[model samples]
Target: MPAPKKPASKKASVRKSTKPQPDQKVLIAKDSLSHSEHFKTFLGWVQDKMNENLIHLQTPQVIESTNRHFMVSGKIEAYDEIWDEWAKFVDN
Candidate 1:
């Protein structure tokens, strides 16, 4: 009862994310022959292409997959190229 209590601030600090954007693509398994298989195959193709592309690339690439999902880590452009060349491997 000596000093009056000060009001506590209820505002929480929200920080803007300054993290660099990830350079990879991710896919989740969701359906039939309209199918996740083709998408799975496509990610495999992307992984293969990225490995080939990485032969001269400064950054390394990594591929990870499971029955439920798939992900490839590296430069996003490599994923885009494989997207353009999914039917076959890139000559790299």
Candidate 2:
């Protein structure tokens, strides 16, 4: 007769995650500027603000413009306090 197969070990049944995933949020901002230089300056300032607030920015800020309107979008990891501060910054 064939030998019986052994049962799987408890450790083998457990799953281990390789890396932890962070909560994420999408951020968007827009501005109306008549001067291209002002738009560039504003974009740099916003980027600095986000960094100072400890935001994990996923992508570089994207800026697009038409006529005299400008828009920017970025992706970042979500943390409540930081997100709130960022929102306030954008609003003002």
**Native-structure RMSD, model 1:** 15.0
lDDT tens digits, residues 1-92, model 2?
99999997776577889896543432223333323466556656655665744432332342123321222122223333444554443433
Which residue pairs collide, candidate 1? 32-35
Candidate 1, which segments miss by more than 4 Å at Cα?
Answer: 1-29, 32-35, 58-92
Q: Which ten-residue region of model 2 has the weakest summed lDDT?
A: 67-76
Off by over 4 Å in 2: 1-35, 55-92
Local distance difference test values of all predictions, in order: 0.50, 0.44
What would the per-residue lDDT of candidate 1 be over residues 1-92, giving only the tens digit for each residue? 59988999899899989997644332221223124465667667777776765553432332223311223224547577656654332222
Measured by TM-score, how close is model 2 to the native structure? 0.24
Highest-scoring model, TM-score? 1
lDDT of 1 at 75: 50
